[model samples]
Target: MDLSSSTVVENTNDFRATSIPTTINGLRFYHELDEWQQDNHFIRSGYVKGTNSYKSSFNSLFYIHNETGNIYSHLLPSLVIAGSLVYYLKFQLPLYESHLQVWEWINFLQFGFAATFCLAMSSIFHCIKSHSHSVARFGNQLDYFGIIILITCSLISIMVFAYHREPKFKYGFSCLFLVLGSICTFLTLDPKFSTSVYRPIRSTMFILFGLSGVVPIVSAVNTYGLEVTKRKAGLNWLIWEGVLYISGAVLYAMRVPERFSHVEQDQASLLNNPMVGKFDIWGHSHQIFHVLVVIAAFCHWKGLVQCYHTMHQDMLA
Candidate 1:
């Protein structure tokens, strides 16, 4: 049989009509016999209309079809990072008292939490919204909010590093810039740009947010000279961060080996199959992008640590 015929047969055999009583939103509805087979029963309804297996094909992690799993993957790490930062502040901040003021510490902690929240929401949007058009719309908003959160975090870092000399000024400026950047990012949430045609613009917006670090970076280099070991360390972190981000972006845009071998990658191929199980989760373009973002954040943290060490040593001297 041809591919289409095989698909029809497989779909027919995979899904059979049954009077499975289902409840959605407190309303009783007869489960349709033409439901498509998916990893997650929760996601099998709504936009997905077909006669096939509705049961999840992969592990529990793979149950939720669409990009929800992808979003969760990012979210789980974000929470861990946020929790670690909180612990650091609560227990470790005192040891670094000379380097950070109470208010500065608070600001950093708050910023970290907010960033985590945004990332979690973004992941949820990708995972659950694909079930319905309205849900997808809302998910898009959450995704944008997540981006804003990242921008807010970057702005906070910039302020922390920028006005290290003036605690009060740094606090105010950081809050102001973060709010402003968030507002701007929120405004750009036009549905038109959500399509593939606007991929470049969307990608550029994210890159712009990431690149905003250059301002504080330049300030650090100019004020604290490249001769300082701390400055060199910050530069090194920045370089590596840029490399990871750029590489991820290139992979996402190019679509790489999969694009070159479309026939080999159809559904089963690592290139096109959004749900090829664990390998796709860890190695896919979006996963790579998520990893890159985390790396960039860590690099920034390194830069901050270097700055603090250098300044502290200078003071001691």
Candidate 2:
């Protein structure tokens, strides 16, 4: 049988309609998608219709589609982070004379790996989702797992640097984040949680996990004073990181720009109207969200570098 056939087959075991592959010539509109392909109604065009073959799906990477921006926004950043990690480890990593140095190096690696993993997984997920329904579902799980890992590791890196002197706080918070990350991983593994129906729930879970960083921030302020905490913990950068993350999340949830593209009465104004479906090939909320996520990760990376310098200075003193 041909893999590119669009014929929908019913599997009696799972009771789901599966579409075989088809040679998709051009982009599809929102209304043209099958149930499995339906997502983001606000994106009314530029969809790569399901091909149900890995070869076909991967080949789409070279073409323009709604997913192109989302894929490259994170994909390119992952490469940059990976390269930075190698450079930092090779030249800047101090020879460990103490446990603090070791932990600092470890925390730095954690942050680097998490950021790269998250971005790469997101790119892969978006790249191959059109292969089939099962592939799409699996990709969604990988994406969620990557996100949780990134959130957990980012917090762990921050806590490690902030409380480098306080062994009790440092180890305590590190363990706390590990446990929390594990819990989140477990929670997201539920198949229902991965569905679009639970998108807000998934977002809330991640937001809450990220917000848990505030606990250590408050503790830092109480123990070391606000100014010292700000200097040691990179508070300003963290705040900016938080703002960027929250902004991205809100934009993704609200589906802005595209959502407003077809609003009545405002359609006459070309700028305000968003050119009616122009965002489909680019500038959609998901694409914006991906860009903001990269920025937020960069801010965290800067904070980590600052924290490393602070640790070096304190060790010298």
- Provide the TM-score for each candidate, comma-separated: 0.66, 0.86
lDDT of 1 at 71: 67
Per-candidate clashes, comma-separated: 6, 1
In candidate 2, the residue pairs with backbone N, CA or C atoms under 3 Å apart (3 or more residues apart, or in different chains) clash, namely: 4-21
lDDT of 1 by residue, 24-113 (tens): 121111134222122222222222222122232112235332343466667787888788787876777567664676656665665576
TM-score of the candidate numbered 1? 0.66
In the range 1-317, model 2's lDDT, one tens digit per residue, is: 35422221112101111111123445666656888878787666667878888999989889777799989998999999999898877666545333345666688888999999999999999999888888888998899899989998998888777787898998898898889889999987787886767767777788888899999999999998999888899989999999999888888877787887643232124334435565766888889989999999999988887777777778789
Give per-residue lDDT, candidate 2, residue 99: 35
| lDDT winner | 2
lDDT of 1: 0.54
Top TM-score prediction, candidate number:
2
Assess candidate 2 and give its TM-score to the true structure: 0.86
Off by over 4 Å in 1: 1-69, 96-100, 166-183, 229-233, 264-282, 314-317
What is the C-alpha RMSD, rounded to one decimal, of candidate 2? Answer: 8.1
